[model samples]
Target: MEKPSDNSGFVDSLEKLLQLCEELGQQIDEIGACLYPPQEISSIEAALEKIRNIIDVLRGMQWFLRLMRLGGLQGASDAFLEACNGLRSSLRELASEISSSNTADIEARVENITLTDK
Candidate 1:
């Protein structure tokens, strides 16, 4: 089997990340439509807003990476792409869990997500 090029691997991971983001957004919207406490809804909305900002930053970084590739500089290195793929997998698992969970369980599920630099 032929090995995939670095660019192709990065692109595949990026595409998956975007798709997962969209899925998570839809899930959040569905949750919003349900009758939850006003405060919980507000908190969810705030979290969604932060997610939107992160997506925007990702888009900007994607463009920057593309420019770097075009300029003959190294784009995302293997380690970076691996990290991104790991994140995408984690997000996918999170989405799966959220979708399987009841409305009341969502807060608990969301609370499980934590950010720590490796």
Candidate 2:
């Protein structure tokens, strides 16, 4: 079987990351309706921290991909494959973190979206 190209992997990773981010944003909006009531502020802060970390990782991966392309890695399929693997790992990590949040409502909404897209 032909191995996947790095560019394709990177693209897939980016798209998945974007979907996670959009869902997280929607979750934040939904949860914000509940008056934090001055006590659960810490939880809100912690959730924001996780969101920030995911955003930073996604941005860093994009930057690294651009650098690799500019460094002439584009012509080398092996190099591209390596880059793609790295991006895939990062994306998967972010997805795991998002899942760990246990935002069932958001998860359901995302699932519904996936179904509708089909």
Candidate 3:
């Protein structure tokens, strides 16, 4: 029978998960800077491309986290798993917003509606 790996690998995976989370935050912040503080069109486009790449890596990290939890040295804590799931949800929301066309136009239209309602 093959011997199972020890907690060392599990600990390493946890570290990786933490690192990925930090990177994800940085990616989101970059996107915010591009959109907010309203930069040039070219800068926003470049930041968007970077966000897409980060998203691809984040997807892989999710898979890695799930696999580690399933075949881990020990079962991961509920809190840990929940936090990871939350991050995944946030990613989905971000994806939807970014994937939508004419976001600024839509925002402007919505603001006008709100003003009229007042």
How does each model score on TM-score? 0.35, 0.38, 0.46
lDDT of 3 by residue, 1-118 (tens): 3434766665666677678668767766775565552333455455556655655565556555566557762355445555545655655654555456466753453344321210
**Which of candidates 1 and 3 is the stronger one according to TM-score?**
3
True-vs-predicted CA distance for residue 58, candidate 1, Å: 9.9
Give the residue spans of candidate 2 off by over 4 A. 1-7, 34-39, 63-118
For model 2, state the Cα shift of residue 35 in Å.
3.9
Q: Write the per-residue lDDT of candidate 1 for residues 1-118, one digit (tens) a residue.
A: 5547856766665676677568657746654553243225444445555554555555546654665566676645334445555655654664465557666677565556576775
Residue 65, model 2, lDDT: 62
Q: Cα-based RMSD of the predictions, in order? A: 11.4, 13.3, 8.2
RMSD to native, candidate 1: 11.4
Residue pairs of candidate 1 with colliding backbone atoms: none
Q: Candidate 2: deviation at residue 18, Å?
A: 2.2
True-structure lDDT of candidate 1: 0.56
Clashes of each: 0, 0, 0
Model 1, backbone clash pairs (residues 3+ apart or across chains), number: 0
